[model samples]
Target: MTTPTTPPTAGGGRSEYLHGLDVLRVVASAAIVYTHLASWISGKNRSWPIGDLVNAVTSPLHLRPDLAFIGVASFLLVSGLVVTRVSLRESPGEFLRRRAVRVLPPLWAALILAFAVVSTGLVREMAPESAATALHLLNNAWFGPYFVGGAVLLPVVWTLLVQLAFYAFTALTIPLLRRWPWLPSAVAAALISVTTSLVPQGAVGPVRTVVAFLPIVFIGQLISLAQAGRVRLGAAVALGAVHLLLFVRADLVSRGIFTPGGGYHNVLLMIVLLVLLFMSANGPVARSRWTRALARRTYSVYLVHMPIGFAVLELLVDAIGASWALLISVLVIAVATELFYRAVERPLERLLRRRRRRRADLERPVDTDEPTPGGNRDGLAGRGADAGRSARQGADIA
Candidate 1:
């Protein structure tokens, strides 16, 4: 999940950086990576020594490997809050542009990289005959696999499509949201509730998945609005309750569509715990250098860890033994994640920021020597500086 640079204050000024979110991001990413590698993958390849150990530890505890998707729940919450914060301060067009710039390039690059890796014959299981087809890559690149019946090269990317849908919804409803922060979410929750109830079982498929997960995002948005004092805390709580109910109902209706996990109740419990952590953890430890650094790399890590880690494990397991191979795979994932962040994500973000600044400069009026009858240039300059600060804070969320 992306961290906001700074949150806007209740009085429309900048607030302190939410260092706690960094802590949450670190936890969320670790949970996800660990779940996939230690639980999910190990369960699938039962021959691995690490799998045996993981199962031994987890089985007694009654932990389902799929319950690890609580990490995804955390991410959706963070994304909703961050995106809402950004949308509040930006024009719809600007908001969409920032989101696209933030999300798309890394995804496209990762898709290409995954395709290349699969083509290399390093991971034979992943390298299906269809893997070489350009259409398969295109399908994944466009998230057609999630919408249609097709293989997803990177399974985690299904969330990205959901995020993109949320972005579009937020952008479209920005005007209404600015006017009445609670209205859009309330209406959406009601609509989803009705749709989920009325629609025949299994008919909506992808649409059901999208709508089912949307309430989770809305809960995040409501939290943001409450924090910003745009909506009353009580009202936000009520709206969040409604959304949570809708989320549960919809998720239950489409139970078989997703990989069977800890059920909706378990997911809800995880979400509540994550939110509690977010609310309670905000001290120096959360603001530590290591936490912040790890937070920045979470998105990059989420993007590449799975496909790349699997490839490394599959390639090295026979030669190095399971324990050593697992260790090496993790090392490779870390290195690749860091490189991808430095080489792809960070640069694209900087380039977009530069382009945005240049466009803003070009759109500005020319400086003139003549002073207005009542307005002071100094006062105007001060206001402009304030706006710049707000814009910078807004960009942090994106």
Candidate 2:
């Protein structure tokens, strides 16, 4: 597989890789886990033998503040920034192909395991029909109620669908964006802001959720462009302020657990993260092998951690006591997700890319002979082409 390339800093030397982004990923993962664990602990009809104790310990957290949703939005922001940086170097077709290969295989692997868990009747709350559920979920149309009767085995997958839509939109718009990136992005942000304002807070279902979050994604794009000097910093800041105001005005900021004290904390947290993103844009970030490894597995962790953690919690809570069950569940699910990354996600992604490259090779016209040495022949020129292609591939994976 091609190695990832760090985005160049505004000062023009080879910029340091963004270590803080990975730290943000880690934070997002933890926030999501916290939200889900709270949900599991406080879920209704708790007839498990240890329910009373579990509630006693975690009941303070029973407040349904959706910190997970905040984390998801943050993820989309970072993702949008990264994708915009990458797409500048890729054709639309190449961008879509690489994205599909990078995301779909691992997600499908997670889905298969998730389905197996559901089929065993472990997930009694939302057992899906074996065949139809697999097909519908695999298809992953942006509409809600992925399975029949509006039962979603893995509600977390909804964000993935929104992400896919964003990818397609980005791919389609890359050409237009090349010329006047700022104006279009600003207009799009405004549109999303208006849309979100029109939608009621509690009434944001699947479609509305995607619509509301798109502005955050646009903010990421704008920040990236501004960081790269393609857009004015002042303009980007103005647009971001408008977007944040719209988001807060919609009451969306108050929906999450991290939003203590009437959502000021949420706003502060977002500003802090954005400041970190800006600061990291131009500086060397400390890195280590451990962080790199964890960063590599973040997506896999995002995919499988929630459902598996909940499953483990349900299976072990009564027998082991609440604290131990929660602890064991986190560790077990994390390790299992890491194993899944190594065994299934990585291999499947590599295989898909190999097949894609092979297909492209077959489609290219055959050259009977190498070019003459003086005529820009195969050594340096060919290597340059290969390097560019590799860079594009690497950027996509990032």
Candidate 2 runs further than 4 Å off: 1-16, 44-67, 124-149, 193-205, 252-285, 348-398
> What value of lDDT does candidate 1 attain over all alpha carbons?
0.71
**Clash number for candidate 2:** 0
TM-score of 2: 0.73
Could you give candidate 2's per-residue lDDT for residues 1-398 as a string of tens digits? 01225333222212234455665656667767766765676573344445455445644544224343546766777777667766654578878988887887777777677777776665554344452365555544323463223556566777776677678878888886667767767666666666665655555355455764566667677766676566777887887777666555545432431244454326334643653554363223325556556656778778787668877877887787666877898898789878998887678666755765676556444774444332112211112333333233234333
Best by lDDT: 1
Superposition error at 307 for model 1 (Å) = 1.4
**Residue pairs in clash, model 2:** none
Clashing pairs in 1: 5-396
| lDDT accuracy of residue 388 in candidate 1 | 43
Model 2 Cα displacement at 84 (Å)? 1.0
Instruction: Candidate 1: list runs displaced more than 4 Å.
Output: 1-14, 44-63, 122-129, 261-264, 359-398
TM-score per candidate, chains pooled: 0.83, 0.73
